[model samples]
Target: MLITRRFFPYFVTQCLGALNDNIYKNVLLLLVTYSQVNELPISVNMFVNLAAGVFILPFFLFSAHAGMVADNVDKAMLIRRLKLIEFIIMSCAAVAILSQSYLVMLLLLFLMGTQSAYFGPVKYSLLPQTLKENELVTGNAWVEMGTFISILVGTLSAGLIVASDNSLVAASATVVTLAAIGYLSSRAIPALPPQGKIEKIRFTPLSGTWRSIAKVRQTPSIWMAILAISWFWFLGATYLTQFPNFAKLHLHADATVVSLLLALFSIGIAVGSWICERVSYGHVELGVIPFGVLGLTVFGVDLIFAIPPAPVDLSTVYSFSTFIAASQHYRVMADLFMVGLSGGLFIVPLYAFIQSRAEKGECAQAIAANNIVNAFFMVTAAVLSIVLLGLLEWSIPQLFLLLAALNTVVALYVYSQVPEFAQRFVSYILSHVMYRVNVTGREHIPAQGAGVIVCNHVSYVDALIIMGSSTRPMRFVMDKSISEIPLLKYLFRHAGVIPICSPKQCEKTYEQAFEHIHQALNNEELVCIFPEGRLSADGDIAEFRPGIERILAADPVSVTPMALKGLWGSYFSHKGGHALTTRPKRFWSRVEVNIGETVNGVELGRHGLHQQVSELFERKS
Candidate 1:
């Protein structure tokens, strides 16, 4: 699927927004600490935190309205307006920095948060309308990866600028420049209108919020999935907020070390997100979430042990240069990479799941609900982190261990509650393992429900190859004798493959196969049968059998013809006069499975169907 013209501009806008948010927020926090050291107290910390809360508070209060606006108005127009609002907010922040007014800066931070609140719902909801279902996971991955990298750059700028002698002037100039660039990018986005009109414009905020929440709750699996996503963000927020303290107090590291840790985490997330699109065959695979959570827990605990002892001189301030010279830098880098890697694995799938499962028109509201939950969880994380560090007297390492343990427990609980997640995991592994297969033109098959697939008989492994490549599950028809192959039998049985005998040899077995095909199609299940009926005797396309036509006539479904190339020499084939070879040399062989467009049963007679299948293979050869 193509990335819509709208995505590029939206990506840049969000990137700039993330950068601006981090740069100002981090700088303000730094100034409060360094400039007013003597006056920096618990009250000051609370006030600064309150500033942070004000930004998130808008998401909870206005997200429902924001979602409505995105769904009701033209998206490109909405984005243009939001970008204008961002310009004003950034201008205010620039002015606040120029005048050295902390009060103005705090207020501007709140405004920035409010702008983001409005953008969040529109950003996600637009994707489904613009991109195809298969592209959703890949598209979401790119956005997430981009957002995290932008945060890294923004935060890095904040640290460097705040540490400079002329911090105020530097930061003010940076914010204005980024905001201007963001606005220009917003102009490039193409127009996208709401798919359908929403009738309730005068709806109460509470009712709208509850109704959006109800949409998610109606699908229990989706609800669980959303909770899982929120929990991930909560853990992420906790880790981010705690990093500086964790570095300074626990690892005896300096600001540079802390920055490196953050960068590594961001990089890992970016890499993982990009990989998710490629690895899952462009589908949202929930299996990766458990793997991600496992990494988070394991590496999070290991990071604690990896921390270096406290420095000999606790009172001294270290420069960025000095921090790089520290002994624990390598250990810190490893831990952060793992955290980010796992984080990437965790988030991309959840976003894809939300996009895929949520009701079509209410996508923005679903995302709004997600943002609300995210904000609430972040608040909870902050409280939890503070309690763990202060009241519980837990060392940073111990806190890391606790977070890891919690991840494991929560992951298990989620998988137990939703077996579909686990089933996807099994499917993901099966596709990747045994052999790597590549399929093309799979989009020709209908997105959902039952269809008949006809293919040239190549080898015993052809069914497995087809199963591995198909996005949807398919039942295969196989010779009864080969179907009994030990290891192959297990997988075939689990996959619901049917056994068939030649009509002349065993009429009952052949009749049963036809009945099974009819039943499967009736239940909206894809049934794949080799019309050639047996392995090719001379490594060439065999004549199409008449049984497939009977199956199609009985079921009245579209027939998809496919050809498996480069498998003629494989051990599984009958070429070597051996049924199965002990040492198969086939590794990384290039195999292409090409699917043809569906042929309407109404237009094609039995002989015509056979001819169509022959023509498809003719082109493939």
Candidate 2:
């Protein structure tokens, strides 16, 4: 996909933009941090945090209008235009660097931010419009990979150039050349009609801002996803904006050392993005998010302790080579890497989730609202750091400690609001780690619309395995007894699992279960039912029951026949006395979920479907 005309150009353009942004921004930051230029009116800490706020302010101010413009125009054309604006901003930045004008550079920060604010909506909205459903996760993964890699290279470039002779000329030349190339790359991107409905081009920024946010709020889950994304930026902004001062003050490091830390952090995110693509299995998977959240707080707190105390000599400074030479510094590098890695895992899925779930017509607006919130949080991060570090006299490491604590609170709240994230996290760990699941015929399960998935019930954890196999949420129709198991019950119940019973157990419960299944199917939800009506107690396929026929008669939706293989002996299965009846002896078992072609129109009775499933099972997984 990256080699194609459709995606590569856009990728190049966006990456170059991120590269140049970091280069120019860091050049200014390094000059101020090292006191290479005329003394600033404010302290170095004030200047760094102030620069972050200046750059992020435009996103808050103009993102709504930008989102509307992106949706109303051709995204390809808008991208090109935005790139051209970037070129002009770089031109002015070049002149500022040559003249050493601190205020001019600061003003250009606002202009650069304005260009990026406009570009953000177009960049995100363009992907879902241009790519296939399965490609969304891969695309987001690649974009993140490119963005962070560019940031890494740019940061290293800025550090090395600042340390070089004729630094001003080199920095000016670099930003302009990159901007021009980014503009040229934008020209090759294939044109795409805007994905949003053409609406009146409203010029009122305040009203449009509210309008976009209101659009996002229409879906509570999407809104929560946006907030989660925003919180990530908040944490990211705090760490990135203060990296220079943090390294200098805490580690007693030079500019080269700061570059090394940023490089490790950036590469970690890129690696995590690549891993997200691999683990996603050609679709966006949300299960890794909680895993990411765990790492963010864990490594973030560790970083505070990982730091060496301030040097006894104020003049002492560790260069990149010296910093890494010591074994103690390895802990700091690893901590930074893990924080970035977790952030990548946490961020990519939320971006894909919002894209897949947001209202189609308002997708861009939803992303715009995300940008607005992200900017708000990031700006707040900047301000909060100033309050903590400057006014309160807290150390940079102390600020990091605060960030980790806040992240935990924020994550718990989001999990409360959006329980599916937590549910998928559990399923994700179970399927991806405890059991290695290889799924075939994933395409047979529709990306949208209603479908019935009837799989042979091999274990009590069948619902979780099937849920993890799917990209979309699957509403499992399960036995009341299994569904009510104390631990699994809470996970399944809140996840919308439908619990059913035989007529003898409770006539009303039996009737309501079918009603709920019908409602789920009518709502275009994927409904999975174990037609065996119970787990295979003897490690063989049980004869499917007639309830499947009742479901088909009621909904008449397409049925996807799936087979769960290699799960008979796992702890959750009946092979070892009883599931969870004794101490667990095995884990990391290999399992396969084979999805057969969707059979529709003609009624396939339970027996017929069972034959197809059996045939699927017979095929080597």
Candidate 3:
């Protein structure tokens, strides 16, 4: 639904660009692989590696400058120019193919890579300019889905064409046509104004790259999200690079089976990317990221064990149908599919968040910085795989288990670095998986600046529900006991939740809660507190505690009253004896959060705030 006039053409342009890049690359790969003419001094393997290196080297060399150029110029015109560059590069590639000149083709590959390098920052940064905040996730989802599907199509088509007698002619014509179409699509993109005055261009890679990275680091949330995204690429490169070996050495499968496994993985990612947007329901729901990481790890570990001992007759290669005939082999493919699916879930939101959160002028630079880090991670994955599988003599399955174990470490590290990610994951699960949550008067919750959200604490997950409903990050001042819940403790701490207790019970915690509240408010953050101090035993509003008064007295900010409806009898509520012991009566009930108008903190006394919250609850009921 968010795919509007500008976005549609932009999306098609990017997809076609990717398709053409891969078509050319894969065609060259096939040429070097099966061509029997001993025309050059280099081995086929070396030539293939050289081609791969040439294509990606530009991202390392030109990304920083590309990012700056995108920031400095009108994006539509820049894209059109890049498309023209792509067309010229492909035309040259076509001539190289016609001449059967491998060296000329390699140079063209580098030129194509340079064109792509310039395209990278513009592609990502353009989304924030062309789409609204709510549309970011959907836009990113479409981009990712298109890229993966294009990869599949391009690779398959290149393979098919390479088998024909006129391989060069077909591949040459295909890339040129795609590039011309990409240029046409670029012409249809709407012009976007320059975000900020572009600074003087710095062509030096080391200095420029460092500047871009520093710009990204200026925003901690953006930095962490980029890291998480890069980690997905790391895991992806590791897994995909090993698939061919795993299929051949472990499953004793032929080329067709290997291609099948890769195709399944690509399809799964596309499905997951689309599913991420659907499940998120127009929100940049980061709550699903951890769930995705869990799926990836669980499936990665499972795949390691799913492979049986290598067959004695290693020479006998099984076709795709024959390989998948066995249930175990099918399970291995399923695991691969899930791994890719989880990767999609893990990456899409992180990308969207960076786009949404980044400062306007530096967005393109930030994306370029992300590209640099992602490239680093991918190269690291490849090197790590080599060390484990070649030098260490570890089997492909063992390498997978090792990588899965390492992924757990990386996920935890990133979550710790940015607790918002963990909080969003929990909120996403609650909002999308456990319940259908609707928030009325979300606009009452300010998009920027500090405020206090006073809400009834009806259930253990009430905080998560409010979090999922509101776009801004909130620091909830919750009961110390609730914050100590083992499953939620880390999530609570990382979310910057202020844990409190009565002065009589814990003078230290009470003092600390006030201190945290002051600090958070001073930093202009939204803080939520349930003045009741505890959950209701019966489905009634508990007496308001004086803590809200204390918080406002210290920092008198606007206070918004909110109520949770339809969660009174949920598993985490006190309708049953103890919340932990209560079984969930309903899994996917509709929960509504009714947010009232922002009342002046000084004007509303404890009784007034209490009355406001009570009215909200009653109205929803």
Candidate 4:
């Protein structure tokens, strides 16, 4: 992708933009923090916050309009225009830095934020337009990695400039050069013509925001995803906003060490983003959300405990090398790094999910909605920081601890609201942790419209494996007994699992299960049924039941036959004995999910479907 014409230039353009933003923003922040300017009308703490809020405020005000513009125009062309604006902003910013004008610098920050607001929609919207479907997650991961890498470099650059003899000259040159290079990169991005036909004579921020949010709310998952991503930004803004103060007051560190701590965090996120791409295996996998949330909460709280006692001398300020030499300091560094690593794991998938799921014409609006919500959260974080630290006098570590606890509540609510995340968590554990699932012919699953997937029942978790393998959601057909199992029942119910039993066992369940299947098919949703009916007790496919034909007869939708091989004898399977009752035979076994071509239900009756599945199962095994 780095060498690809469509991706590389865009990547460079966005990354350079991120770098220039951070460089200019941090230079202003560090000067006010360490320089102890006497001209400030407010307390240093309040001014620091005011500066941060000034930069974020434009995103809230202009994002809706920006999103509207991005959807209605050529995104590549718009990006080039935005970058030119960015260059102009940076050119003026250089003079402000050289003159040491704090007020002018703050105003420039707001202008920089305005450019970023417009750029955000175009930057994210262009990915789906330029890359292949499979490349979405990888693409997001790479961009995230680059963004953080640039952030760390820019942060360190700010520190060195401030420490230099001619601080003004160094700061002036860096932002201007980065901005100029970013503009050049933007020019190389291939044109992405507008995908939507909606005509608007002008951009309306307030109305556009409300309407974009309404459009986003049309899909529950996307709406929740936007909230999740916004929460991430809120949490991120808190930690970043407090970092300089956290370093000075808590660690007794200088400006260089502040940059050092931030560098570690940024590097950790970049590394984690790379790992997330590898973990996803070319799919927009959301299973990692729970995992990311866990690490985020865990490490964020541990950071408080990891902070060592401040040096005996209040005046003892440590240089970068002195700070790292101590063992306890390592814990604080590691904790911050893990927090960032977890964050990287958390955000990439949500970006890809919204991008892939949103309508092509409305993708920019969706991203714009995300930006608006993110701005609101970040500004809230800023206010909360002020109330707690300024009004209440809580330490930075205490603030960090409270935020971690809040993360648990927020993550629980999100998971509870969207059980598919829980379902994916189960899938992630099975496929990535318990077993390595290799899927083939995934393209057989209909990209759109109704489809029925029939697989041989090998284990209790076949539905999960099938769900994980599918790009779309699958409403699985399960046994009545299995559906009633503890813990699994709640999961099954929310996941739209259809539970059926023999007519003699329970006529109502038998009838209702088929009814649900028909209803799901009519909605053009994917439905998966295990034709073998029950888990194979002897590690072989039971004779395929004819019930599949009965369901297909009602809707006659495209029937895709798939096989699950290498699942027999697993802890979940009824291999050698009852399922989950024996010691696990293998910890990281491999399973194969081979999906065959879709066929008409009327043409391929139960036997033909069974034959196709059996051939795929045997051929793969």
Candidate 5:
């Protein structure tokens, strides 16, 4: 339903374009293998790889120009023009297919790549402009879902069509027809105003590429997202490029079986993408990424062991059904599916985050930089595959192991750089999986700038639930004893949550908490303090502590009052007894956080702030 008006046409247009691209690509590869075109004295393997190379080469060469044009002109009109170019290229491809001209086909592939290179930036940048802020993650989900599904259909169609005619006529027809459909769909896309003005257009490939990359690097978060996205592309390219050969050589399966494996992978990604929209509640939840990468690594490694030794008589081909007849073989298929599913979860958030976080007017250019990096990573993956499989004589299974291990390293590095990813994930698990969290007046949370968030402390897990609900990250002030909880110690530290104690208990710790709070406020960061200084023994508001006065005196920041209702009797609360000692009564209980209007720092005193927070929760009660 959300896809009806503007998003649907764009989705169809993008899906058709992806389908045509893959159909043309797989058709060329199929032609090299099955067609008797011996025009040039090159090995079929070399030509197949060459076709792949030509398709991606334009990304490195023209991405900067594409990004600039996307930002400088009307995106809808640009898309229409790009679709027209695709139609013409497909027409030329049809002619090339009829003549069985390898050189001409390769050239047409380059032209198609050129068209896609230009479309790439426009495709991603258009979302933030056309859709509402809330729709971004879901929109990205649909787009990614469509892209992979198209890949599945295209690969299957190419395999079947080429094998049937011993010629690419059907494949050619498919691409050309899809191109026309894409152009028609493009016509329905509403025009969007250019994001930025381009005073002049420059086409210097190397320097322009560097400039674009440099622009993205200015925002560390966006740049890291780009790198993570590129890594996914690298993993995807390695798996996809090897599927046909992997099926034949590793599984002793026929072309149809290869298509079947690809179909499983594609379907897994589509399912995962669709699910991401539901689990994230329409926001770009960085929490989903860690779960995704964890699955990616775990299953990727499992795939190494799932692969059985090759059967005798490697020339024998097996059907899809026959390939799955063995239990071990089915496990391999499952592993591939899980990898794809995780891949979807890993990429959609990063794409959404990039679109949301990139400096205004530079979203297109940032995505273009991402495209450049993605292309490079894919190319590198190809080379790495060759080195490991060809020169090092490592088996494909071993390569899977190496990739899995490398993914773990990358995941750790990324989480270390942006602890928010892991922090958000922990919050996500607590709020979504362990308990259901609902929030009212969530808009009261400031979108930007510094403020002090004051909430009535209800439970040990209150901070985690609130973190999951908030759009922006906040550093909470917690009791020093609670910070000693083994499971949460690392998360609290990484989230920069300040821990304090009473002056009598530890004067030094109490003093240090104030310093941290002051620094956080000065740095334009959101700092949340309980103000009560400890969790309530009874399920009622405790006396507001004087610590709030000290914090306010130190830094006169806006005070936002939030109430955590329904968390009074939760597992991490002292409802039955001390938290962790008492048995839980229920799981997945509904918890509501009601945010009230922000009070000016100078106007709201400690007693007044407590009264305000109490009234906010009392109304909900």
Candidate 6:
């Protein structure tokens, strides 16, 4: 399995890290549970919640420095050093456990948070460097699955172990053992160095943070993606922190029941993450983002309804088996699973998009900016939960619905601001509906710079399909009559398509079109023209027009020949004297766009170029 060799070590490291984190955290919660001062004026539960918030605060303050370190140093070495730091932190945690010191435990929690903050940038930024572009979604999926599974195991084990007779010893042994495992995994990771040179580390935390923030802001899409990621964490933190209370108070369950709910949630996320890699076909398909948001909105509301009303006299001894006896418990579990699935669909794409599009060598910094925003959002969630639940007397179910509605508003706003995400949605729909487009000899088109593309026009949407496939933008020349088609005219005009009439019919229109083509080529822009000067009347190659030769003679540029096949039977094709009718028996049509060798303008005249291009098309057909 690809997960075994390439992803295992990273997975092990993440799992161990999460295990250590939760073990130590649950031990602290256990201390609060058993505290002699639990009856004090201030709520012990509130203090525990505040401690959780404080742990994430470091990410906001220090992520910039963390990003710099990840960018400057060897990544494997950095992981090794971070693992050593974990060992020290876990040792401190052990001491806190042995001594039963809340102060020490709280301090150690801060230290653990610091370690995680430092690792955040390196963890995400390393994926793009190590994995191929095609492997990114799968690699991220495995990582996310490992992280969540660890959380489930760690949360469950911590509750069971700390509730034992020898709580201190159990906690100490668990943390130290996990820390050792983490270190071993770090050792196994192959060496990966910073991809580029590093500048001097910025010591001013605020300034460094602002600078990192500014870099992301400069790229609108990156900024939007960061916002999306931040919101995910914010919503997740709120839901996760509330689960234990919800299971215990609302469902009249116990610690084991809470653990079971957590397990289901984690498993759902893992399953969803794994599925995202497959559904996306290895690319960061933004089309999945809306679907994810839809699921989140639907399942989130269902979770509120799924929760049972407060039980009279809640039980403290509910086990996993006993919890499953209640139908409401199963309903809650199903809701959590759906939530996890939606979250998986949402997060994987955002991370992949950020990795793929961020400025090279500054990925760590960009991710660092995202972490900072995420921390702020988490803080907001914490504060909002406190005010709404604690002060305003809002029920947990009400809060869940509010969050769901908020998700809809936020998703719409983000999609409106960045049309690329929506554009991908359109492209995805059109590609599947129109036909499967196959391109051959695509490498013949230069990766960079301008070239004139001459092809035999086959259908109305031919340019749209080609535009969708071509990595570089091209200006197309279309017949004046077709260019006036209502909806298509808008798209054509926006795309800078030039309209040309036959020279015999409208000589001035023909001259103006040629001038526009000339200007486009001189500006080093790709310009595509139909050398047949008209669509094929009988689905056969037509005589070549000399207009291409005239354009080429004016500017000596390489000419790329292309053909459109299977489009002959498309809805827009001239069939049975009705332009709008579809070809019979055409449920799934196969269209191929084949590009031929670049013909030297100086060597190939109009007729020679036309013959070569036509033959290439016939061969491809």
The lDDT per prediction is: 0.78, 0.88, 0.86, 0.87, 0.86, 0.80
Candidate 1 local distance difference test against the native:
0.78
Q: Is candidate 1 or candidate 2 better by lDDT?
A: 2
Question: What tens digits encode model 4's per-residue C-alpha lDDT throughout 1-621?
Answer: 767989999999999998889889989988998999898777777877788789888887788888888988888889889999988998999899988889899999999999999899888988988987779889999999999998888877887888899999989998899888988988888889988787684667677678778889989889889999999888988988788899998999886787787787888888778888989988889998887899899999899999899888888999888999978799999998998999999999989989988887788889989998998898789889989999999989899999999999999998888899889989888998899999998878887788888889988888888889975788988898998889688889999888899999999999999999999989989999988888888877778788988887788888898999889989888877899898987978889999889888668788888888889989834
Clashing pairs in 2: none
Tens digits of per-residue lDDT, candidate 2, 1-621, equal 878888999999999999999899989988877755456778777787688779888887899998888888999999999999999989999999998887789999989989999999888988888888789999999999999999888878887788899899999999999999999999999988866578887777777788788888888889999999999988987888789898887888887787787888888898888888888877779988887899999999999998876667789889989889978789999999999999999999999998888656667778899999998887788779879988999988888998899889999999998888888888888888898888899888887899899899988888888888887888999999999998888889888988998999999999999999999999999999999998898877789988999888988999999999989877788886888685666789788899999997236798899898998888884
| Candidate number of the best TM-score | 4
Model 1 regions lying over 4 Å from their true place:
1-6, 37-42, 96-105, 132-138, 164-166, 196-199, 277-291, 310-319, 326-328, 356-359, 417-420, 448-557, 563-591, 605-621
Residue 503's lDDT within candidate 6 is 82
Off by over 4 Å in 4: 29-48, 94-105, 162-170, 196-202
Enumerate residue pairs that collide in model 1: none
In candidate 5, what are the lDDT values of residues 1-621, reduced to their tens digit?
356667888889999999999889888887788766677678887888788899999999999988988888888999999999999999989988878888888899999999999999999999988886678899999999999999888888777787784455677778889999999999999878786655477788889988989988887778888989999889888888788788887888887787787888889899889888888886778889988899889999999888888777666678877787867687898999999899989898889989887756778999999999999999999999999899999987788788899999998888888777888888888877778887777778876689989988888888888898776779999999998799889888888889999989999998999999989999889998898888988988888888888888878888899888888887788888888787788898877888999897567788899888999888843
lDDT of 6 by residue, 493-526 (tens): 7678899998888999989999999899888889
Whose lDDT is higher: candidate 1's or candidate 4's?
A: 4
TM-score of 2: 0.92
The pairs that clash in candidate 3 are 287-424, 287-425
Error of 5 at 181 (Å): 2.0
| Selected candidate, larger TM-score, 3 vs 6 | 3
Q: After superposition, how far is residue 606 of candidate 5 from its true place, in Å?
A: 5.3
- C-alpha root-mean-square deviation, candidate 2: 2.8
Task: Kindly give the stretch of ten consecutive residues in candidate 6 with the minimal lDDT sum.
Answer: 423-432
